[model samples]
Target: MGVVLAGGAGSRVGGADKGLLPLNGRPLVEHVVARLRPQCDRLLIVANRGLDDYADHAPAVHDETEGHAGPLAGLVAAFGFLACNRQALPRWLLTVPVDCPDPPRDLALRLHAALAADATACCAFARRTGKPQPLFAMYRVDDDPVEWRASARDALHEHGSAWRWHAALEAIGVGFDAPGDAFHNLNTPSDVDEYERAHAAS
Candidate 1:
């Protein structure tokens, strides 16, 4: 299933629901759904509050099971939901952040390609600077559910957060040159303005 991690409170955007934020007159989550729909047979939205808004757009809604637990919480929930629904677990889960409305147009296709080339490792988008964009990657859901739950508990103890998903994955970086600046996110009012200007020009 394709997953959009929309659980954050978006404190950076004046406490606005970033997923519901407008992008080219459509909800940012809609842009995400459009890009990801072609990639999976099912789509899941992982959110904290405002799950109804996401559910309005997605086929399924999986909230952070542990509450305010962060992205890893969302990941764990997605895995659990899938395990309960599908007879066999899927090989991978495609994840993207809610705020990034202009993620790579070919994100899903490229991630699948990367995974096919290297079955042992997962894939993540990387900027030219070589930093992994953790939220915009695909993860191999191979671990035991109990083990993942334990990891989530441990992460909550040490960092007061859920599992460190990026640190756990065997990540292969997918690099881009002249990476689309449109991927710049709407964190604040100024960022929204900048994105609007850039988006208008495109």
Candidate 2:
């Protein structure tokens, strides 16, 4: 299953819903969905607001915790949605933040391979130029999701950092040879404008 983490507070982006913000004439989440769809069997979007808008792209699920807890909460929400719907747990849960308009095209393939090769790794995340990106990760889902969900919730309650939680999971980092700007995040309005201008010019 593929999940888009769009439930951020957007504190740096003038409180705007970054996922719903326009980039290249389309919502940021739309661009992410288009890139992730073909890589997975099913897609889900985790958003705190604009559910209807996000739903237009894929089945949108709200965060389990309120007040934009963070991406860890979004992970919990994804697991909860699957449990609530009685859906079979996918072998791997692939996730990417919505603000990252362009992620590695072979994200899932590389992460899956890394996890498959490492018997001790509970998950695998992308690392660009030695910088770990926990948001763009693939979590191994065991036969029962209870343990995984519990650990995620614990991490969410203790510390809201995705990297911290991923560390506890012994996640492997799969390096990508993509450009340094491949995972450029649109955190502020200026970032969005700059990206638009750069891409439009190219």
Candidate 3:
């Protein structure tokens, strides 16, 4: 299953929903779904507001955790949703932030391949320019149900970020050297300006 994590409140962008922001005359969520659709058998979105709008692109989901627990909390909800929906669950869950409009074409393929080849790894993420992009990754299903949920809850309370959870899973990081910087995201106003300027120049 492919999950586009749009549950964030986009606090850094002045509390506006990042996925609904305009990019090239279309909602950014639309752009993200377009790119990820081809990579998975099923596409689902995770958004906190404007559920109907997001559902127009793909089925939308919500984070079960309280108090804006962030992306890790969103993933926990996604996993729980999948747990109840056994028939639609995929062996691996591919997640990308809704704000990233230009992910690499082979993003899912690379992460899936990396996790498959590594026996001990439960997650495989993108690493580029010597930096790790953990959220844009593929996670293999945890066979142990009880521990999985607990681990997620613990991570949400403890680190407040996905980094610790990624480490706990023994994740594998796949490297990329593409010049296009496919993982570029519109997380802030400056990012939007930089991307627009770059696009206009090109």
Best by lDDT: 2
Q: How does candidate 3 fare on TM-score? A: 0.92
Worst 10 residues of 3 by lDDT: 142-151
Residues 116-138 of candidate 2 have per-residue lDDT tens digits of: 99878889999988999899999
Q: List the residue pairs that clash in candidate 2.
A: none
TM-score of predicted structure 2: 0.96
Give the winner by TM-score: 1 or 3.
3
- Give the CA lDDT, 0 to 100, for residue 184 in model 1: 60
In order, what is each prediction's RMSD in angstroms? 2.9, 1.1, 1.8
Please rank every candidate by lDDT, starting with the best: 2, 3, 1
What ranking emerges by TM-score with the best candidate at the front? 2, 3, 1
Point out where model 2 deviates above 4 Å: none
Residue lDDT tens for model 1, 1-202? 6888887768888777788988778888998888778777778898877777888889556664554567766766776677566566666778877877767767767777877888677445444466567667776566454454455456545664322544654467777553565356667867777888876887
- Alpha carbon deviation, residue 50, candidate 3 (Å): 1.7
Worst 10-residue stretch by lDDT in candidate 2? 80-89
